[model samples]
Target: MRDKVVAFVPIKLNSQRLPHKNILPFGDHSLSWYIFKNLLNVAGIDEIYVFCSDEIIMNYIPEGVKFLQRDSYLDGDMVQGHEIYQSFVNLVDGDIYLLAHTTSPFLTSKSIENALLNMLSGKYDSALSVQQKQTFIWYDGKPLNYDSSNIPRTQDIMPIYMETSGFYMFKKEHLLTYGRRIGFNPYFQKLNDIEAIDIDTREDYEFALKILETNKQIPIC
Candidate 1:
């Protein structure tokens, strides 16, 4: 039998960088509206869990979506994403879990389904969105991917993949048993820079708007 795919979106009212960001107006829909709408369009997703605490944001949640009331303790500024996941593992059931966020406002449904397909393929126990940055890299004030004495073409440099946190999918047992989001072997799904942009600062939010306008393919789910 095939495994079921459940998506969990952890939301809170207080945002350190942008207060009430999850509910912030973005075009005709709020920040999370896009993700919610897109996920609804995804046939691969068995369920979409809107894990939230703020009632104000509930208004943004569309009809027929599953609402998971988050504990007030997990809504604090210091609470980590993994901490929230710990709370979810005790509640939800699925062979594969898709954990995403409103911060990734432009996360494409195609990407979401693709990630789910990758997870179901069993190539890796887990999968998440990432961006390929094939640029100059460095660490601890030392050249990381290139040599100071001998320079190589940009194409010759090994590309570095950065976790975009746009979306993630993992086997339910992988998380519940190991207490980690990903298993020993994980698949990194590469996403384009524009599609993988994460909303962290004010500028990032604005950038997402531009992307949304340029690409009309993103529909309201």
Candidate 2:
């Protein structure tokens, strides 16, 4: 029998850019709570597990969300993602895993569902979010995506993608092989500007709130 698809959220309380980022007030609930609630709306996910070492986040976790208490040592800001990700794959039971973060509030459930559908299409080994850029790109004082000899019109510039780290979906085998979130031949799904907003600084946090409120993306209860 094929195993189930699980959504994994690795959230930490410590932050340098924004203090107590995970549980900070983001609208009605904390930042983590907002994201967790959206994850619940997504269908086809058998389990939704949140791995955190902080006790404050425990208060916001509602039903359908499994809380995994992580080791305090792993809570250190210096702890890398791969270390925790490898542990998650080993400890969690799932054939496919969707890795999401609470900080990227713009990543809605619909985007995740679409990404998963594309991921399971069998054209790519993995899938992740990105932002499209269609401006003049330079590398080492040289033009990229344009021929220096025949500098094309600005409108004709080929677009490039910026990995947003908003969300990622990968098979267990890919995680076991590379010990990373993405694998070779990973598909990049470009997101709209609003959907690509990642909160790291105070400016970003404020901007995200504005976007959510202006668009009425906030869930009504």
Candidate 3:
């Protein structure tokens, strides 16, 4: 049997950009619910833990899911995600750990399943969701490479990888040693922009709603 995998979702009510974004309803469910539900559905994921600060949000959580109130120090805006991830790692002892953000509502179970399969089969130390993009390269408000003559087509520019903040998987031991979801040896799983949406601002939340509405997948309940 495959080792049990524990998933920790970090959430907080306070947000400078979009307050209470996690509990905000996009369709029939809140943004956090979408992510939590997907995590529950993924194969090989043995447990799902919501490391949150708000108590009201806990009431809506489905039965069987675990909730861990975040420490005050880790609840601050300046706190890094690595700190919260490590805290949960210490609480739950699992073979593999998956850190997912509540803001990423577009993430699907299949995407998570594939990532897990790749990690186990490929023997990767860690894996993260990324967007494979290779558009015009720019830096510090200046175009670094505008001439396509020297470089290959945008599709062939070695595929610039951007962390989508969608999902990350790592071995428990590797995470504790490296103190990051991405361990020493990390692998990337590419996701489309639509599936990589992370709600940080009002504009982002609104955009996700539009996408779900257009697709007619918005939960009715």
Residue 12 lDDT, candidate 2, scale 0-100: 78
Model 1 misplacement above 4 A? 213-221
Number of clashing residue pairs in every model?
1, 0, 0
Order the candidates by lDDT, highest first: 1, 2, 3
Model 2 reaches what TM-score against the true structure?
A: 0.91
What's the distance in Å from true for residue 52, model 1?
A: 0.8
Per-residue accuracy of model 3 over 1-221 as CA lDDT, tens digit each = 77778888888878778987778877776777877787887887888888877667776555567988878678797988778888888877998888888887778878888888888875787789998777787778765655545766776565468899889998887767767678776778887777888888899988888999998783221
lDDT at 71 for candidate 1?
92
TM match of model 1 to true structure: 0.92
RMSD to the hidden true structure, all candidates? 1.9, 2.1, 2.6
Give residue 132's lDDT in candidate 1 (0 to 100): 90
Stretches of model 2 off by over 4 angstroms after superposition: 216-221
Estimate, for each residue in 1-221, the C-alpha lDDT of model 1 and write its tens digit. Answer: 78888888889888889887888888787888888888888778888888887666779867667888889899888887888997886788778888888888767888877777776777788888899988789999998888978988899888898999888887777777777787777788888877787998888888877887888545543
- Which is superior by TM-score, 1 or 2? 1
Per-residue error (Å), model 2, residue 207: 2.1
